[model samples]
Target: MESGPAIFAGAAFTLFGAALLLWTGVRARQGEPVALGVAPRAAVALTTLFGACFLLLGIWCFGRL
Candidate 1:
């Protein structure tokens, strides 16, 4: 497998995931309003889960590289 593209993709995923996680953390810390329909806790949980998935995917891709 070509490590170049994989590494780039992994870095992108990691950065995006980190950004989402940071945003969620800031929102929670600031007691900001969450999106409609979902409860505050659920929203945070979902965001965290999504961010974790992305982070893990990125790590796996980086490992491949």
Candidate 2:
């Protein structure tokens, strides 16, 4: 596997997860629910999972490099 691809994928996931969390925060501050589709807890859980995956992938990529 190429370290470049892994790094890029990890970065993408991290960015997406961060964006989701930030969006949720903004919505919550405005008195809106954290999730627009699913339950707020579910959305937060997914976001947390994605963030963890991204962090692990990034660490692995760095080690490979």
Query: Best candidate per TM-score, number?
Result: 1
lDDT of 1 by residue, 1-65 (tens): 59889999999999999998999999999999555678999999999999999999999989986
Query: Which ranges of candidate 2 are over 4 A from the true structure?
Result: 36-64
Candidates in order have lDDT scores of 0.90, 0.68
Residue 58, candidate 1: alpha-carbon lDDT:
91
Q: How many times do residue backbones clash in model 1?
A: 0
Compared with the true structure, the alpha-carbon lDDT of candidate 1 equals 0.90
Per-prediction TM-score: 0.89, 0.57
Residue 60, model 1: lDDT of 92
Residue 5 local lDDT, model 2: 84
